[model samples]
Target: MSFTIGTREILAEPRPLPSKTVRYLVPVLSLIVGLMIGAVILLASGHDPIAAYKEVANRGFLGELPMIGTLVIATPLILTGLAAVVAFRMKIWNIGAEGQLIIGAVAASGVGLALGEHLPGWIVIVLSLLAGVAGGAFWAALAALPRAYLNTDEVISTLMLNFVALSIMNYLIFSSVSFWRDAERLTFPSGRFIADTAFLPRFWGRLHIGIFIAIGAAVLLWWILRSTKWGFEIEVTGDSGRAAAYAGIGVNRKIVSVLVVSGGLAGLAGGLEIGGVMHNLDPRALSLGVGFTGIVVAAVARLSPIGVILVAILVAGLNNSGVGLQTMGIPDDIVLLLEGIFFLCVVGGEWFLRNTIRIGVAGQPVGERSVP
Candidate 1:
């Protein structure tokens, strides 16, 4: 069956492969579309979109301090964005990066606090980062196990686990007198500060070695996905599970591995935040929706590892520009609206790129097309 677009029959047939140009153009077009839409919204709200955008640029990247702040914000976002990329590349909807990140912070903090007195600063830092990775991996396993073995819906499981992870973090710092909480603080609920040595070394103005770690991770991930056999199988599996099975690939194992790796990446972000920025497991400081934002970064970058870095920085800049928008008499919500618009446009553009539109005579028979 076909619908008519005016006098011609319209068909949206899945293509075997989208054009390379279209792949690149989709993002560019989406950005332009988002800007146009945002401009309209800004005009309607009696604000100058151009001035607001310029202010955003000035605040996010035009100066040294602003650039540093943007990088600081991008540190965690890069890790989380990479996490989303890993799971999403294999068509796994692992939405628990948020929880995984929190759990990672908890594990890193617990380990750092417990071992701080006995270990050297460098040792403590290493151990804390490892703990973060392990924590995130374990948390992801909670959802991955069911998905891999029981054929459960990972989307629901992962999303639910995010709440559980948040609750766990809250319980540690806010509700219970957990080890992660500072016992000395009698009035306010606060997390214990990590050992001084555990803090990630900074290069400039709060921009720590974590940015390097994030960049290194992106590079490593890019290499694995591009040059490794495992990556090839993941690509094949993502393209078609049945085809992957036919080729003797263990689809289930890949699911668990990819998800665990994804979680580990997210967890590493938490560890970095603790060591490089926060130096403590402050729930308020950590719950900035960084994990959720990573999903958008992943999608906008079209799941490219390196692209994730660029997108994360851009997205971080957008978020950082909220203050600038307020200065321009624009509500910070305008930034949110613009972000939402960009995300929607990118998602829609992706859909459009995947399907080819055909014009045919009414009642004409169309040949069968393979579904992507």
Candidate 2:
């Protein structure tokens, strides 16, 4: 017996008549589907979605100072999301944002402890902020050098680096109390408070200047990725590496530089969390995993910087609203449940955007006229 194979076999490919409207429409529909799924789960669990949503909105959005609170929570989210977007656009997976953020907090703490009260407050704050950015960038650059020069797996390098950063932070805070530990907090290991000048001034009780910083950074990054020569290089690199190299682009250099910038943004988030809001460094305080959440934001936003801002707000609001929902006999983890659904739907939607699978017998020619 002999077997015959055609040039075009059963396979998935770009749709012959792809709907442009579906590209945008599907993602939006997926979100709605995800929410509906979540609602169904809630109903099955003997809970009322309408009541829960009402409570969530009232407590999270309509409550006193809710808007500012949401913005404040979203600040780090925006920065970290932007950080992920920057590196991801270059096909660099720098998964060490959490570590970079921790190290940034450590660096900012050191600066705050040293010059918070002794030197001019304004000068000290500036130095402290710069130090935080530098520290994060330094950590990212370390992994970047290995990836760019030695072709190392960044996923492993960057992730392991996070443990290193967290360990160092814990060691400094718990082991050496002289510098980092606050004397008054004898019950627990804690760092010193930042300077008054270093503290980002608050408006309307809870909102801080970090809101503006996050927004400004988002706008600036959006502009950079949209209208600059470097932006074009990033877009090109993301689309095709071979194409980039053929175009005389320095792929390795771009990788390293983009990672550094990504790390710096993550670090800046740490600084804002430390100086603008918390005013003290503690590992527990930052255990909220803002970096990881930012990754989700970046993925959901499709790496668009402007979209990052909106997505960050939505995620932040989800978190706060989830917490609020707890008072109504609901668990906060339900929000995470919804997020999981959202992610899966987004993945499915993107898959549909690129290709459509056609059912056919195995070994049959694809896109061919079949004999009846």
Candidate 3:
């Protein structure tokens, strides 16, 4: 008996690497597609797409107060976006940012209400900001510990922690003798206003100093991620944990570090909400899912720090126009629908760009085969 041995070489056709232009262009195209889809839905719902869009655009972008209002609302979104980007970069999903943010506000408000009158303006401001960062970091570290030591699922822990944090905040507001509880305001469940010294300085009319802080944070984060050794470790950890481990990187430390930083950023956002805008720790003023919206913003920006800023502005603009849409007889639900469409389009486009499909057999050339 005789046997013949044959070797066949199989190769996958080279996929072209996407250029920077294409990377950006895809998201823009996705936005256009999402808008078109939204317009169709509007028309189907018996509303004039043109009028609805016009109203949204005019109020969101062109109107005097609306534009500024968008920026005002966008302040926290920027911070949360930064938080999401930082965690996402390290492959750590810190979904508890919302909770962390609340914790930060609670802590900062505690400090402000306690010593705000006696503290100097600059000192109060600094202390409040630091307190916010500390609060967020502490909350994030709670999740980080289990992730690092017990290898618990971070998604579950972080998400559950959000509810816990919210409950804690609510309990403090309603039950505890915290400084935020306002006895004079019987109609609303609100906290006492922090002293003027504790408030953040405004840049222009309604623009608070938080905007500058957000921008500076983004710039600093960008620098850290691109230039620092810790940044390199985070990138490597995200790319491949096994590889990072092999390279002597402390996986546990990196996880904890990223979560702490992410939480601190989110906490700062809460502090800004109280000190820069709200001026009090009100449970109702906490979040309308701004932290979650930040996840969308981070995704839309492809988790780039600079990109997150742009996406945050766009989302803020849309939210700002939501009221205008309502005034124009359009349903407020449309804004939510548009946001969902935008999120879907951006995520889908990114996924498509990163992966491709082939219809042929596995390990075989598309148009060639040998058979007996």
lDDT of each: 0.90, 0.83, 0.85
- Which regions in candidate 3 have their CA more than 4 angstroms from the true location? 1-14, 355-372
In candidate 2, what are the lDDT values of residues 16-39, reduced to their tens digit? 545878867878998888778888
Whole-structure CA lDDT of model 3: 0.85
Q: Please give the ranking of all candidate structures by lDDT, highest first, separated by commas.
A: 1, 3, 2
Q: Where does candidate 1 stray beyond 4 Å?
A: 1-18, 355-372
Mind giving the per-residue lDDT tens digits that candidate 3 earns over 224-304?
999999998999999999999999999999999999999999999998898988888878878578878888788788889
RMSD of 1: 2.9
**Alpha carbon lDDT at 146, candidate 1:** 94
lDDT of 3 at 132: 94
* Candidate 1 global CA lDDT score: 0.90
Provide backbone clash counts, one per model. 1, 0, 1
Q: How would you encode candidate 1's per-residue C-alpha lDDT over 46-154 as one tens digit per residue?
A: 9887898899899988888889989999989999999999899999998889999999999999999999888888999999999999999999999999999999999
Q: Report the Cα lDDT for residue 109, model 2.
A: 75
Model number with the top lDDT: 1
TM-score of each: 0.91, 0.88, 0.90
